[model samples]
Target: MKKSLLMLNAILLLTAVSCKKSTEGGNTGIIKTDSSTTIVTDKNGKVDSLSESSTIVDVNGKKYEKTDFVYKATDGTLVKVIFKNDPKESTVAITSNKKTFTLPKVESKGGETVYKKDDMTARVKGDSLHLEQGNNIIELKRTKI
Candidate 1:
């Protein structure tokens, strides 16, 4: 009887710990994944857990995520960025020039999202998305609706 009680207590304790809220960086609904692990952020932008995902895609022996982000520009330009969430290789594709550009996560600074491939780079700053190549920087802002 004592052993059963101890086992029940342990299970309840584990459940309490796992259900705690996650607050990663004030950005929520972000899912990051790799081959063996997936990290999810809650709506308040907190880290939930390091686990695996049900929506996974195998690419180059790594797991890609189906969760993506889309932002529309005022000029009727639509930009889409696909995420895989790997620590080293996060981005799968970025939309530019009426074409889809495949890229990866480069240098991330100040908790902002940045993707790059060769000389092209795309960065997100709040509601503004910036794409840079050579000396030209194109800025796209989201229209408030």
Candidate 2:
């Protein structure tokens, strides 16, 4: 009887050892059960610790959600802007009903010589002016008004 019991114990131990498996893939904590289903686990084998989802990325931040108006910088009746691309550091953006020009490195950050009415719907910068339209027509002038 003792010999039989010892042999049974040895067999059980071997079976358990053979059934155990070592996980690979550098501990991503994600296990694919099937083509349509997946299981995510944590360091301690707990599930649902962290979740991930798709998100929209905006490089210009929330400027599009503010308003639909053009920006320009001018002094009195004199326009400073003359052409686009002069201020290589400035970016021009537009929307359906408006446009926006962001100059992170302009004479004044928020200062713009705005125009919307008449045949002169234009933005005047220091020594340059940009025309606005449905597409991006923002330009940077190198001169000062």
lDDT of 2 at 105: 22
- Which whole-number lDDT from 0 to 100 does residue 110 have in model 2? 47
Best by lDDT: 1
Writing each residue's lDDT as its tens digit, candidate 2 over 45-85 gives: 67532222112222333211111122233322212221122
RMSD of each: 17.5, 28.5
Number of the top candidate by TM-score? 1
Q: What is the C-alpha lDDT profile of model 1 across 9-120, one tens digit per residue?
A: 4754797698554556543344433335345574477764322222465555655555445555556654555556653557646654447787677767775778788898
- Count of backbone clashes for each model? 7, 14
**TM-scores, in order shown?**
0.49, 0.19
Error of 1 at 111 (Å): 1.5
